[model samples]
Target: MNYRLKLIVSFALLISLAFGIGGTLLISSSYYSLLGEEESAIINEYETLQNNLMMINHFSSASSAQNMQELIDQMVERNMAHWQALSIKSSGETILESGDQSLILNYVNSTKEGTYSYVHINEGSSRRLLLYSKMSTKNDVLDLRASFDLSTSYKQWKSQLRMFWAIYVMVVILGVAVAILFANILTKRLQSLTNATKEIAGGNLSMRTGLRTDDEFEQLSRDFDIMADQLQENIQQLKEDVQRKENFMGAVAHELKTPLTSIIGYADLMRQGGLDEGDRLTAANYIYSEGQRLEKLSHKILDLLLMEKDTFTLRKISMRSFMEQILTTTYPLARKKNVNLVVSSDDVYIFIEPDLAKSLLYNLIDNAIKATPEGGNVKVIARGIKGGCEFDISDTGCGMENKELAKITEAFYRVDKSRSRAQGGAGLGLTLCKRIVDLHNGNMVFTSKPGSGSRVVVQLFGNMSQEVDYEK
Candidate 1:
């Protein structure tokens, strides 16, 4: 059904087929070998029986012919139960006296010179062993044969075959199970990787194949996760850069238009040819003021453009004084909105890029001030954590929902884009902060509840000299 299952089943079927073929070959060879051994044993036994029978004839010839039949019978009986003596009239082919009269008559009737010395004694019995000879001093001769049935060897071979097949089946079953088990384990790992890849292809970068074993599948899983993580980060960065460029363009246009509009209005008034000297001077001053606004907008645009690039470094700075300086700079903006901006920190010295770090804190505090209603509160807090520092910016503002917070870090994603722009931001402020933190090997966490408030926490690991390899 699946790739993994296909591989597993294919392997299992191969083993089963191989076992069956090998077992059939072994059984066939062994059966024939057993049969050959049985035939050889019977042949050897018959040859020995013929030799013993010839010896009996010698004994009978040496004895007296007075009670010839009696003497032969007595001697044959003493020799063995299966052998018996007999007297025969060879010319008429009749038995005169014999311990086995019917058998002697049958042999005499069937005998002819130059016939087989050993052969089957009966028409219906192929297993019979026969030895016939002409009489030494009489026309009568002696005949002897030993016959056997194959019932015993047949039973033994059947028993052996049954045992062999039983063991064969058991061994084959175990072999098949082992093959299937290994195949399934390997295939199952591959299946997980395939499914995870599909999810990743569909833009679900969080999907991962969590393999427990140390093998090719595990290596593949690690590679896939690393690839997905890199891809996710690259896509995020590209989106942010593109959005920042767009927003920078828009803000510059708007900012330039405002100043240019005022400048053009003042110039037009002066060019009307009827203005007083004082009024003309007033228009020049207004144009100058508008032109300065253009300068301010240009500076902000430059800052936004730089934020789209990668530059993460640290400069030795006091964490407490840094927070104080940011507050001093942004306090006027907070006062304009009637919002209380509070700053607190655990005293610590941090090595950080002051410009970028200041930009980060400024954006957070500024956003909080704008979002907070009149008389509302915005707080900036910093602390020294284990091996790192923690910065938190919180506001009693119209917060965000879970769905909005989830994608808040995504570029160009703003709950209030127009309001954010009017507040003198490119909306790349938080996104830039996140990138700078990432470059510093740090993390950003956003916690928010609609209508309640929002808190943004930034955790930046200390630039400590240690054996910890970030790549690992």
Candidate 2:
């Protein structure tokens, strides 16, 4: 059975059993107590009758059956309303009898003297309490028998039993109705939880059991909501991770295909043996340049993959020397691009993984130089802050729009795809730089306007800086 029905049935059965037993006991006890009182009164009356008969036999001075008969008649007439019958018998012969003689016959004979015996009897529609005794008379031993009407007491008992059952049935019915209502309320909460579970299983992760019973069920509902929230969050994260992986793979394939196609076409031209020496040299140079670009792309992709899975050690490095080295290395490129390079720093020791840190600065500087027009400025500045260091790389190049700045750190995302490809950019530079910043427990912020130059800010924290020792 369903839980609601089971609860109802269980409660109903218990109530009925308990009430039936209690009511039956109460009514039966009351009836029996009343009957007992009536029986005591009847016994008292029988004893009084016997005492009066003995007084007549002792004081009347009559030793004859006729005298006894007359005295018994007078006593019978005196209390005719109390008894159904009264009879006097001696030597197997009845000397005096009044009222129903059949009542006397129904009673078993008691011959022993000085002891009275009583019994209850049902005859037809009437009930009787029979009392019998043998008493010593003036001239003979007399057996006296009497029957008292107990029909009223029996009727009262029957009426009480019927009334009690009627009341008991009503109480049981009301109790069952209350039980059903209570069970429905309890099971309603459980039903809501069950429905929520089904909805979540069916891909509705936002389902919740909104119960507020101020009890254990409420606590359970809260816990269930928490579990659902966690599950939805984990599932969303998995989906995002999967989509990212797919995008990365597609970008990798596209990058490889371009280089491979160009290299193959040039090699096929060389193998055909129809081109002049200059044309052949041109094909070879094109093949070599594409090969170099492919090599750079492969290295950048490998670095990104390794960064995801590998841990690096950090060591203290002098910021002044680090910036000088970066400027010197990128000076050739900046000169070739005809872009001005400016540098500034605070002479502080900063913790970094040296090679990765250099790579990070190189990518940022290279992108800045490439984005800048001829005679435009690319500036790099580093300063020590509280417990850390910050680097600001700003370019007076053809900067980017706000929209492009938002997606610049996504893999293979380029602001100007043709210009980027012509400049031999695979669009992984900022993606790789972002990953490096994340590894250092740093934050990267990009602010740009369409015409105005863009600025990239890198803030590295967590044991990032100390004062340089000039005395040493």
Candidate 3:
């Protein structure tokens, strides 16, 4: 069933049931009240007749039936016309009477001694109340009866019943109306949510319910929107990751294919025979160089893959001692290239895996040396800063523009591809450096321009205690 109709029907039935019971009770109560009022009036009449008869017994000396009848007529005449009939019966005979004989007989027969009784009679077009009482008068006992016209009270009860039924129906109608209004509002909100979900299912991922109702439904809508946003973001991230992997695979294939082709071609030429010593030497050299390049590329690729699985144990190392060791290690290459190497530092320390940290520093320094020309300078500086240490490796090498700098850390990405290949670079150096720094929860920043020297700053977050403080 439609929810709105269900709500309306439920509400109407409930109201109708409640009002039906109440109306029935009300009609019964009104009927009983009319009966009670009629009874009270009859009792008052009986009391008056009893008192008047007692007075007549004390003062009047007539003593004959005629005198008694005359006295009863006067008494009856003095009373108001609240009843339709009055009667007095003695010795199985009615001495004086008015109104229906049958109704009075029934009332008297059914009446108990020393008590009053009443009966309702419907005589054609009118209803009547017959009241009977037995009383002792002077020397004889008499049955007195009266009939009250009840058509007015009956009409009143009918009117009251009609009014109650009307009210009950109105109450049910109003309840149904309110229920439909409430149901429509509720169903409208639910429909909005349903529509939004359908839109999302149809691939409109950005769809949302902008419901602002201050209720649970509104909160639910907000939560749904948040879930959709997160879902969209996660999907986009997954797509980018897949694209990156595809690009990485393609680059790896191309890099490997070049060296393998050169090595295979030259080796095939050497094996073809009849080559001179000079030609054989040149071919052999070319094959060896390409083989070395392929070897280096394989090791770098292995390092990249292993970095994903490797866990590191970190220890604190003094920045001054670490820098001195770095300088000692790279001095040979610096001297070979005739590039001046320098170091300056303040007391600082970093917490990192020694091997990974060494690799990171070595890669940066080697790249700096390769980029710097003969007679140019390369400076390594370490400094203590609040909560951490920083290292800057600046070189008077050919710097990269912004476009190249942005992708400098991507695998197999190089600004000067020819120069990088000639220097035996598979372009994984900065990528590895970045990974190591990330493993240590550090950051790297590069400042470079096309003509100016590039400065690579590495920030490691850790203790930066001074040497004197460390000793203490």
Per-prediction CA RMSD (Å): 10.3, 5.3, 4.2
Task: Work out the TM-score per prediction.
Answer: 0.47, 0.75, 0.84
Question: For model 2, which pairs clash?
Answer: none
lDDT of each: 0.67, 0.86, 0.80
- 223-308 in candidate 3: lDDT tens per residue? 98999899889988999989988998999999999888888888898889989999999999988888898898898888878989
- Candidate 2 regions with alpha-carbon error over 4 angstroms: 44-81, 87-101, 109-128, 131-145, 164-236, 307-359, 373-377, 381-389, 437-442, 460-472
- Top candidate when judged by TM-score against the true structure: 3
Clash number for model 2?
0
Q: lDDT, candidate 3, residue 201?
A: 90
In the range 1-472, model 2's lDDT, one tens digit per residue, is: 9999999999999999998998889888988898889888888878877887788777777555576566666765776338888888777688778788887785686557978988778877678888899988777788889888999988988888889889988998999999999998999999999999999999999898878889999999999999999999999999999999999999989998998998999899899889999999999988888888888899999999999899776777888888898999999999998999999999988777778888999999999999898999999999988866899999987778777878999999999999988888898999999998988889999998877888999987745343333321
Q: List the residue pairs that clash in candidate 3.
A: none
Off by over 4 Å in 3: 2-6, 11-42, 45-79, 107-112, 118-130, 149-154, 214-216, 310-313, 462-472
Ten residues in sequence with the least summed lDDT for candidate 1: 463-472
> What TM-score does structure 2 among the candidates reach?
0.75
